[model samples]
Target: MKALFDTIKIYPKLIITFLIVLTPLFTLSLVMNKYGSASVKSEITNSMLSKVHFYNSTLENEFGRTIAIMREFARYDDLDLLSNRTEIMNYYEQRGAIRNLQKELSVIKNSSTYIQEASVHIPSIDRTISDDNFGTIQQDEFDALNVLTNHFESPFIYWQDRLFISLPYPIKSNRQPPDFVVDIEISIPLLKNALLQFTNHTAGNTMLVHFEDGWRIGGDEPEGFLQAINSVIQADNADNAELHSATVDGQKYLIAFEKSKTLGTTLIMYERESTVLGPLDRYTVWFWMISILTLIVIMIVSYSVYRLIHRPLRTLVRAFRKVEHGNLSVAFDYRGRDEFQYLYTQFNAMVQRLQQMIQEVYEQKFRVQHAELKQLQSQINPHFLYNSLFILYRLAKKSRDENQIRFSKYLSDYFQFITRNSSDTVTLAEEVQHAKNYVEIQKMRFASQIEVAFGELPASYVDLTVPRLIIQPLLENAYKYGLEEKETGAKLTVQFAEDQADLLIRVEDNGELADEELIANLRRKLDVQDAGLETTGILNVHRRLQLQFGAEYGLVIAQGESGGFSVTIRLPRTTSM
Candidate 1:
């Protein structure tokens, strides 16, 4: 019971923080993924709607163009005058009328497509001795023509075996009576091609299939072939009768169906679906690509955000806890020189200074404090001597053999650096050696519990001057926070390398980051200098680096492989300060 209470007293906030942060992160990940998938689906749907609109627009354009051409031909001054004449009761007596009709037919036959014949209606024709009214010979043809004259002038373009338009014009009767109606049938193949043009595909074998009559308005031969056009409406009842399906040959066509506004008959347009949607089918492929691209973008953005914000914050929190637990010299490692590097430096220094103060006032922890009484106490910086002595003391107690002798030598070098703050610039060699001393003392204290690996430092690069104790404090941090949690032996790797103009020092350990909430709490405590409870070694390094080298080079923390952490510090080879 006492041991559990003490453990709780030690890491109460840490337990709470781990539960809080982990749960929220998992929730955030799920929400983002769900919405991200919805966004991709919406984008794909919008693209499909656009394609539908495109198809409709194309069909409308083809119809509009054909209507315009028909209107243009109808508006000719001569044709209009002949057709609009109310005074002409009969037309066979008028030579001028016949000539005008002949001329209009010539123009339509030559200018229009699939137009085999074109002629004007004549009411009176006594010279021929033969007459055919609306329902006499071909009632369906006459009715289809009546549609063009009455309704929308929406003439159906007929193609293939049983397709043709019924165009009705007023014909005149001679000495007998008044008005007469003549039905004009014309071929309509060119118009089919024009409509198909919008789809970017060809109209193949466009024709009306019928049993006896054959392909009516368009196609080769004179109604020789026949088939059933599924869409071509054919009927004969008491009130109406159309040229029903004619049987000349046998074959079936699933033709396109269109209604005539004027004649009340069905105009069948035959063409295959593949022929219409083939070229534009590539758009479907592009649509698929767009969907795939959106998914990739969402995945990438989610991953990047996780790395930039979530991962870093969590790492700092864990690091902060180590510093919280009196690990003032905690390692704060990161890759690339960013704002976090500065943060790492501040955190480590603050914690270390806080720990040193705790040591200086070790009596305060178990001793008394008065709320009203003020006591004058001398402040001492134990970092100068105690750092050396603390290492030796711990080593002497741990090894019990040569601890006193090894620590004595470390203490002498420590004083030499303490008294002589003269040479601000030390060779890379000197910095490397100084860092070695710090690590060796810790190695002795921990007693084979921390494994230290040093990268080879070139002799020629040793003459470079560096801020004293730079690498030592960083190494101290790795031991303080990262390696302290090791079960058996913690591995510490130090590398001293120079690029074109900068020296890089890296310290790594096989320890996971501390709890995030603890890091934040400790940082707050450091700023407040919350008695001897908070660590602030990172703050000390931050200030010292700024005081010695500009405001750039400093500590940074990173969660490396297997959740281990690393600390990196960059120092310019020729730092002016």
Candidate 2:
């Protein structure tokens, strides 16, 4: 078994695995396609039947309500009086009765959404008054309506291409016109609109058909199609709602119909079978195509396994071996438009990026070490120590024990921090404390000449990490160069402020001798690209900050608004170093 498995390589294994997986899937799809298509057809039929029945019920309710309203209006005493001209003997009496009848008709017309106009016809007065028109209707039009009233047995009648519901329905067996008729013209447009809502999203047609009168309405299809549908309904003679399939003009259709009991009309909704089953038919075709193509693909993949997979894999393994041996220049070249080509391209790019990153890392390490050495060399100044010790000595000699002890402690902390050389960065709190210590020592020496104001450090920024000894040098420069000229009221301010982008630590001295030329010279020195030229002082701080963060976050030196030299150390607003 082991030998057989070992002898069968990846090419045959892949083909065997794909066949095992796909054969059952193909069979399953065929079975599902048969059942799924049937399910879809059944669902469409039920949906269409449900929609048609709903719309039919809606129309029946509307027509029934309108008929009820007309019947009620027909029984009004004013209509009875107006029906008999002899009862209203005078012109004023007749006019008043007709006016009252018109008012009632207006109210009834406005009450029902389906009532386009409510009218009253009086045979004795030889006039028809409607809510829409106060004048009499045409005599010939009235004669036509009268004829329909006697002809149609249903309450709903079609006369002169208009639909109406007339009161005093179920005409007498004598075929004689009644004393007065209350005719409510149905709003065909509104009815059509209601019917259209059912088929708005579907490729279906809706029609309202009156079989007895051969009246068809509310459809946009051709008259021949509608006539064909009418013939089917007539031949079936099914009064109840039903869903059926029929063939019309060489095309099959799914027809859903419901009969309106009140109006004796049928609402028929029909759609082409293909329209409903198009997606399923397309899926069936696609399934067969995919099955055949999958077989072809199995053969194609077996052929390509050697050319696409085997060769590229060998090349990749060789390239990896070269890289393992420190040969980073190895690259894989594949020109075919396939996944193997993408893999080879990415491999080449990764190798190139690895080489580039190695060089960057080396250069960055060297720069950091060089900057740290300069910081160490510049911070360990003998002159500053001499001044601090000398100040301590004078204080001890004067028998000021408290001042001596305080100065000694500040001096100890300051020198310990500068000499430790443990880390390249410290918290803002530590740096600010160190700067404060230097300020205190300097204040002790130059108490009479200088007045220093050190702003409180914000608690939020206390933990921010920054380069070591970045702030102290600025204070040193302010005291040594800025406060040297002023004797009285020589204010030196150390403030911390922050904006959206950077944290600013400013050192300003009210030196009257400082001018634009000095500020310009200092700015020029900061902009110098030659890193080896200036390794200490403000230049060192600026370069170190730029290297740590980015070039945008370093230093800004300008003349103080009042009269002094101000140097601001701008560091990025970040939580970590």
Candidate 3:
């Protein structure tokens, strides 16, 4: 079993892996395409049904309230007085009751959002009293209203392009027109507005249908389209609210409806079938296309992998083994025009680079040793040591015990730090403390000639590992070169600052001789490639920082804002070397 496993190559293994990863995805896509459509259809159906039921209930409640008001107003004793012309003709005597009755009609009309007008008709007197008018109605108008009451069993009647709810509903006998009829006209525009709410949300059409009477209130569709929807609804024969599918004028539609038993009407909402299921159908096509595309890609990738990766990898491996055995002359000779061609060219260049880098490494070692020797020689400056010992001797002869003790201590700490060459790097705190010791020694030597302000190192950067002796050189240079000529008011400032990217230790001095020409010379020296080998001053610090951290971070020198010179030593903000 182990031998057989070892015999299998990368090409077959990769093909097997591709099949393993993609088979389940293809199966999952097929499963989702099959079941997902049904789930989406069910959700759409429930949503449309809920909307249809909501609008249907809204219409029923509004019409039901108007009918209730009409029925209640029909029993008022004032309506009976308007039944005969004698009671109505007694103008002065009945005027008070007549005005009261008109007020009541107005109240009823104003009570419902759907009520356009409310009126009482007296057939015997041929008079009508409405919310707005009290006068005789046309005989044709009375006849039209009278005929509606006789024909429809429901109080909700559609007559002569108008919708109304008449009192004394569910007319069973169709006897003589009731002595007085209370008619509440429903505002078609208001009903359309109510229906528009549903249609606007669903991008559908709405209809309030009186199926038996063949009348509808809210659809601008062709008669055949409306008839087609009605046929589908009747064919469904569902008493409860339902969603149905129908074909009208060769265009498919999805219809949802609920019947209002109180108003004796069906509220139907229908939308284009494509509009409802377009997303699902489009997703199905994309899913199948992607599944097939992925399968083809697997096959094509397997072939490409064998032709591209497997062949180049083998050739590169052979070249690597020859180089691993110390044969530096091995080179790849690939001719194909592809990424492998580039890789082969790079491999050949890399072998040549290896030979050249060997010689450069040896030269670099020699240079580093030479620079270190120069660094050691500059650190033990005979002039600086002579001056320091002479100052101690002078302080002792002056019989200044306090000055001797303090100066000796500062000198001891300064020599101890510089002479101790145990490591190439030290903590920033230790380096700053060493720099302070040198500054203190100089202060005592200058004796009130210089005002030195040493800034406190921030706690965040105190523990950072930096190249040794980087900061102290800047302060030494400031004192020796820049401040030596100043007679009085020789101000020296040392500050520690940091930003988002680097930590800066700035040393500035108010010296008379420091000028732009000196700063430009220092900057030009810093830019020299071999500056690290020549001097043990700012350029040495710059090169050491560049070698340790990066070329971007080092020393920057410029004119100080205090009419003097400033030398800033920049180090990366890091916790370790």
Q: For model 2, how does the per-residue alpha-carbon lDDT over 494-537 read when each residue is reduced to its tens digit?
A: 88887886788888888876788988988998898674666777
Global local distance difference test of model 1 = 0.50
List residue ranges in candidate 3 displaced over 4 A: 1-20, 33-37, 81-93, 147-153, 168-177, 201-203, 289-303, 311-378, 382-409, 421-425, 445-453, 487-491, 508-532, 546-553, 557-566, 575-577
- Residue 414 of model 3 has an lDDT of 89
lDDT of 3 by residue, 1-577 (tens): 7688568887776777798988897888789787999899999899889888888887777667776777788778767666644544567757766788899999998998888999888776777889878888677666666654432235667778898766632243747676876788889998787777777545478888888877887778989888788778778777679988888888888889988777778999988888889899999889888877887888789878877766569878989999888898988777789988998899999999997897798698658845673465347767778999999888888966787899999999988888776677789999899998999898887888999999999898888898788878888888888787778888999998987778888899988666789889989888887733565777778877777777688888888988788888887778453
Q: Write the per-residue lDDT of candidate 1 for residues 200-255, one digit (tens) a residue.
A: 22433433223232324333434333224432443322222122223233333223
lDDT of 1 at 183: 24
Q: Output the better candidate (1/2) by TM-score.
A: 2
TM-score of each: 0.29, 0.63, 0.78
